[model samples]
Target chain A: MTEEIIIAGFGGQGVLSMGKILAYSGIMQDQEVAWMPSYGPEMRGGTANVTVILSDMRISSPILQEFDTAIILNQQSMDKFEKMLKPGGVLIYDPNGITRPPQRTDISIYQVEAVEEATRLKNAKTFNMIVLGAFLKVKPIVKLENVTKGLEKSLPQRHHHLIPMNKDALTRGMELVKQIR
Target chain B: MADYKLMKGNEAIAEAAIRCGCDAYFGYPITPQSEVLETLMARKPWDETGMIVLQAESEVAAINMVYGGAGCGKKVMTSSSSPGISLKQEGISYIAGAELPCLIVNVVRGGPGLGTIQPAQSDYFQSVKGGGHGDYRLIVLAPASVQEMYDFVNLGFELAFKYRNPALILSDGVIGQMMEKVQLGSYKPRLTNEEIVARYGSWATTGKTHDRPRNIITSLDLDPYRQEQFNLKLQKKYREIEEKEVRFEKIACDDAEYLLVAYGSASRICQKAVDLAREKGIKVGLLRPITLFPYPTKAIREMLGQVKGILAVEMSAGQMVEDVRLAVDGKVKVEHFGRMGGVIATPNEVVAALEEKIIKG
Candidate 1:
């Protein structure tokens, strides 16, 4: 099975890093993964995004016009990418930041207050991890354990201590998703 | 050896350079190519592999650093986009004149001036026709994917050292910024400095000694015959390169008629057109040149004897089409379809041009 996702938001929203973490997790799980960032001058502050494809087979093209899922952290991103989702696709958005829901009726939508949830964990930047945790709960493309292993392998030795905190955040997000569902 | 890992094109180039045992890397930051510097910096090649990585003040300084490292018989490289590469022509010409072995990468963007930082193949003529002054040619390798980006970095160094000439990795912003599954290859280290000095030190400018005559690396020759001899040597080397280094991909060109000739980013778009034409039974194929300098003239000329017409597709305003026409020598019709000034030609536009030029004809 192949899954393509686009993580989009403002420049400082950690959108690119979130995609990179997903790609690293896929690689650790023995799946083919590609992470392509929006390059050139367009990535300064105006809608920075990354396209990630995780597949059991080989990936042909890294440029994807349609996505299986879209994780939007802001309303602008939600508005820009809402129409490009595939039929029966999944969309994960931040309810606190985006007030308006997507107009499409063919896809499943999950609205999580990621910023609020992460702030409850005392780290607002862990909002990306909350989204990742929610993504793992719904999709099950990669095992949650594999993602933790990936985090350990991908990060430097000095930052290894953050793994437990990220794991805890991920578990809390999974629980939050279950509660919301 | 064939294991694959997902990597960006710029990161793949850096990894490939390290695998090729690149001795030194000096470059400035530019869009579409900053990842090349970032990857090198993150990897800390200096501490790991004893490779030197330096961030120069500008493109001019970086290329001159290449000149310095290459003068000392060390494997060196520097990368930039179009405008930055334009600033490096002086140093490139100097490197060419000195007959130094160095690799230069041009992650091309739209240009004539400080154009937008988007993918464009408009640097075709500037790269292949000698962007700098004087009679010179660099071995140019055009990579279409991340895998080729990894492979060509090693091949570039090999070609540069084998011929004592400079080499270029000509890539566009699409290939640079895009990510693909790249199989990381085993690191093949080059010869040590001591070994290179012992082998080619007779001519390399290390130092003047009492037992040996002084070595000069200047290109200035006052006598006309000396300059002519230099030109002849360059021509001979180029001929050898053309005979051995011309690389092109022929897709479904063995049977039936119409052909599409493209390279770089345009080649990927033309592949879609070819596939669509096949579905309609138009029998269209693609001929993509991987080496722009060698031009793949023989392959194009061979196809001219079989195909009805060939459409030259590019991001520039028909720069490479001139070479195609010259190669075909008016044997078969060679038409051009291109978009200039940072515009990309869509598959529909290319197919429409093909229909008007060949299918309907």
Candidate 2:
């Protein structure tokens, strides 16, 4: 099985890291994975995106024009990637700061109030984790055990204490997500 | 635990250099490839492996430092993007003239100037056709994946010292920035000074000894006839390399009616294009040149009768297409498809170009 995914949002919204964590999780499951990011000065304050592909076999291309899933965290990303999803694809997004929500009837859409949940938890950094949790709730591609292992691998040793908190955020995200279409 | 780790292509190059026992690295920071220098600094290979890593003030100084290290018969290297690489042309020429063994990595970005920080294969002409002055050719290896990025470091150094000529890893921003699983090789110990004397003492400037005259590392002969003789020797070496070192990969070409020629990042994308076209029942194949300097001319020649047309795909304004045309030699139709200034061509775009430019035309 192959899953081509794009995660996009503002630079500071942890868009790239979420994709990186997903990629590491794929690796934990012995899957072939590739992570390609929109890098450089574009990450300063502008919109940033990353493509993560997980496959059972060799991945053909890290760069792609469309995606099987688009995890969007901001309006800019929602407006840009909503139409790029394949028919019957999944789109998970946070409604915070979004002026226009996704308007595609062909793709399945889900909303996670990750910004509100992170604020309630008093951990702004866990916002992306919540969004990732929401994605897992809609489509359980990777196991939570693998994701925990992935988190341990990607996070530095000094920040190991945050794993439990991130796990909590993910759990809350799964609870908070609701299907819109 | 498995030996595999997820690493960016640039980071793989740095980690591989350390693992391969590279003696030293001298480089300046440049966009899309600055990670090479950053990774080396962070790893502190000097402490771990006694490998020296220095951030030179400028690209020119860095390349000259590479020249000096190579003259000492050390496995040395330097890396930069397009603009910084352009600054090193003169020193590269000097090293090529001196016939020193060293590795240079050009993680190319789009540019005739400081164009963009995005990835592009525009440097194909600059790499294979000799970016530096003179009639010198670098053994250019184009790595399409992160694994190849790691593997080519050892291979590049091997070929450089084997031929006593400079080698280059011609990469682009995509390969440098993208992350993938890579199984690293075993660690190798750095060569000692005594070992260098034993292996390269014939030509390396080790020092004057009673057993031999002082070895001079100079590209300048000053005498016209002597220079001509040296040039002929260089040409002969290049011809030998062309015969022995040409490397490429053929994908799904057994019954292909059309072929796509690409290398580095473009090749990875073309692989997908080949798959997409095949799904539609089009017999398309891909020829990925692993070694760009040798150009895989013979391989293209071999496919002349089988494939009806050839499409040269690059992330430039069609540089390698010239080489493809040369290989085809008017026997069949060959066209070019590309997106300049760092815009990558999609698989659908490539398929469309094949149909429009080759099948229809």
Candidate 3:
């Protein structure tokens, strides 16, 4: 199985980290994975994106033009990535900042009020995790247990205490996801 | 070997250098390659392994420091990107001229000038060819995966010491920045000064021992005849490296009609293109040169009759392809496809180029 995914948003929105955690989870499950970020100028608080490819076999190119899934967290990302999604592909986005929603009819579009939910949960850091949760809920390519282990692997030992909050955010995202036709 | 850990390629190189007994790292930070120094500083190899990690004032100073440390028979290394590497060329030539065994890592970015901080294989010419003005050769290792990024640090040092020549880990921005599961190697202790003398005493500058003449390290030869002799000696050593050190990875080539020749980051994209072309019933293979200087010339020559056409894919505007063409020598169709200035070519694009330029043509 293979999942080519793009997660794009503002720099501080944990876009790169979300991709990293997913890639880490893929490794935890014994899958070959690559997490390639848009480096250099784009990372200076502007649009930041990472292409994460998970496969049972060896991953070839970490860079790709099209992806099976586009996890967008901002309007700019939505605008840039909405057309690059494969037909009948999965598009998951946070509705808080996105103005022009995904208008593709052939592809499956899902909405997660991840920012609002994270605010309600009193943890802004969980915002990406919530979106990640929505992604896992739809894709389920990786098990939730592996995601927790992924967090343990990605996050430093001192920050391990926050894994539970991130888990909760992920779960809330799973519950609040709405598919838009 | 240690268990698998998800790590960036730059971090893998730093970790590998520490584990592989890299005695000193003198480097100046450059974009897309600063993580090497960042990781080393965080690990504080000095406190743990007694490895000297210094942030030099500039790339020129850093490479010169490498030359100085290497002259003492220490396993020293310095890392940089495209522009930074250009500054180090003079010192690299000096090290090569002196036959000082050292490792230089070029996590290459776009070039010509401070072009861009993104990944590009444009430095292939500067790396595999003599970027420094000399007739010297560096055994260049092109690591496509993060594991190789880790593996090559140890391998580069081994080869450098083995050949009494400089070794280069020719990496790019993609491999420098991407994260992958890397199986770390176990730690190897640094060689002591006594051990250095005992092992490399014939040519190393460990100190003047009564047993033999003083080991002097210098690249200067004012006498033109003596310089010519030295140059001829270096050429002989380069020929030896070419004979024994050529390394490459061939995928799906046994039954292929067309071949894709690439190295380092460009090879990764070609691998995917090979698969995609196979799906479309195209017999496309991938040949990845791991050792760029000691190039797999004989191997590509062996594929002369088996492969009908070759497309040398690169992240630059055709640098390594020149070497491939020279290897094939007009035996079969040879062409180049490249994406430069940090623009990465996708698998489909490569396949399309192969079909358009090689197969359809």
Candidate 4:
């Protein structure tokens, strides 16, 4: 099975990083993956998005018309990508940022108070980790263990200490998903 | 001969260049090609292998630096995208005129102006027909995947040094940005500066000793006949390159009736199209040009004996198709299908075009 996802938000919101983590996790899981960013002039102030495709076989194209899942970090991301969800696709949004729910009836929507939860955890930047946790809960493409390994491999040498804190945030986010469900 | 590791195309190129014992790298950063610079920076070639890595102020400066390094008989290289490559044409022409050995890489992006930073094969004519003025040729290698990106880097440098001419790795954004499994080749250490000095010291611009005369490296000749003779020598070198270095891939062309010709990223897409066409019981084949220059005219000319029609597929409006038509020379019905300005043609679209334009037509 192939899972195509688009993670989008403003630049520096870690949207691209989130997609990269997912793609790297897929790689660690011994799956074929592709991570493509929306490059060129559109990346200035407009919504920046990255497409990540994880498959059991070789990925032919990086571009996707309909994604199986979308992680929207901000309201603009939700407004931009909500319509492109395939039927029964999952929409994970940061509830603290998005006030309106998706209008689609066929897809499942999970709104997490990502920023608020991260703020409570005393690490506002970990909101991306929270969204990633929600993504794992919905799709479960790779094990949380694989994601931890991916993080260890992807993080820089100096920032390796943050792995535990990020893992804590991920576990908390997963627990929150369970509580909401 | 070894196991493969997953790498981006740009990283693969950088690694391959290092392993090939490239003496120096001078480049400016540009999108779709920036990872090349980043990879070289992280490797710290000077600390590890004593290779020179310089980030130039502009593409022009970078290529001129390549000219200087190459003139010293070192295995030097530079890289950039379409716009940056356009700026480097002047220096490239000088390198060609001076008969220097250097590798130039153009990781292509869409454009006429500062166009979108998306994969494009639009630089077909610019690369193959000599981007700069005068009668000169660049041995252009088009890479389709990350693996080819690595393989071609070594091959491009080898061809440049062997032919005493500039060679180019003509890749596009798709190959540059994509990640795939690539086998790193065995390291072949390049010649040292002193070794090069001892070998080509007669013509190289090294300081003169008491017994030796000063060397002058210039393309200028005051006498018209001397300049004509130099041009003839360059032409002979190009002819030798064309005869020896034409590389291409033919997929199921043995008995195929319709031939689809493409290169770079577009060729990979056409591979899928050929597969789909065969599944539909259509006899279609793919001709992928790995080396854009030398034009692979020999292969295209040979294919003319069997193929009924040819479809030239590309990301540009119709640049490479012109070359294909020239090679075919009315032997087979030749047509063109393309998408420009950062748009990629899908496999389905290519199949549809082949069905309507060549197969059923």
Q: Candidate 2's residue-wise lDDT over A67-98, tens digit each?
A: 99999988888888999999999999888988
lDDT of 1 by residue, A1-181 (tens): 9898999888877788778778877877788777778775557777788888899975544555678998888888898888989898988877776778677888888876778888887897787888888878878898887788668756789999898888887877776763222
If you superpose only chain B onto the true chain B, what TM-score does each candidate give?
A: 0.96, 0.99, 0.98, 0.96
lDDT of each: 0.84, 0.93, 0.91, 0.84
Deviation (Å) of B163 in candidate 4: 1.0
For candidate 3 chain B, the 10 contiguous residues with the lowest summed lDDT are B197-206
Number of clashes recorded per candidate: 0, 0, 0, 0
Worst 10 residues of 4 chain B by lDDT: B199-208
Model 2 misplaced regions, further than 4 Å: none
Interface alpha-carbon RMSD, every candidate? 3.5, 1.2, 2.1, 3.7
Kindly report which residue pairs in candidate 4 clash with one another: none
For residues B221-262, what per-residue lDDT tens digits would candidate 4 score against the true structure?
A: 789999999999988888888888889989889889899999
Which sequence of candidate numbers ranks them by lDDT, best first? 2, 3, 4, 1
Badly placed stretches (over 4 Å) of model 1 are A29-31, A40-42, A56-58, A86-89, A106-108, A136-138, A143-145, A168-181, B1-6, B186-193, B197-201, B208-212, B251-258, B269-284, B305-309, B330-361
lDDT of 3 by residue, A58-134 (tens): 88888787889999988999999999998989999888866788888999989999889878888899899889989
Maximum-lDDT candidate: 2
Q: Which candidate would rank higher by TM-score, 2 or 4?
A: 2
Models 1 onward score TM values of 0.87, 0.99, 0.98, 0.86
Give Cα distance to truth, residue B348, candidate 2, Å: 0.8
How well does candidate 3 reproduce the true complex, by DockQ?
A: 0.69
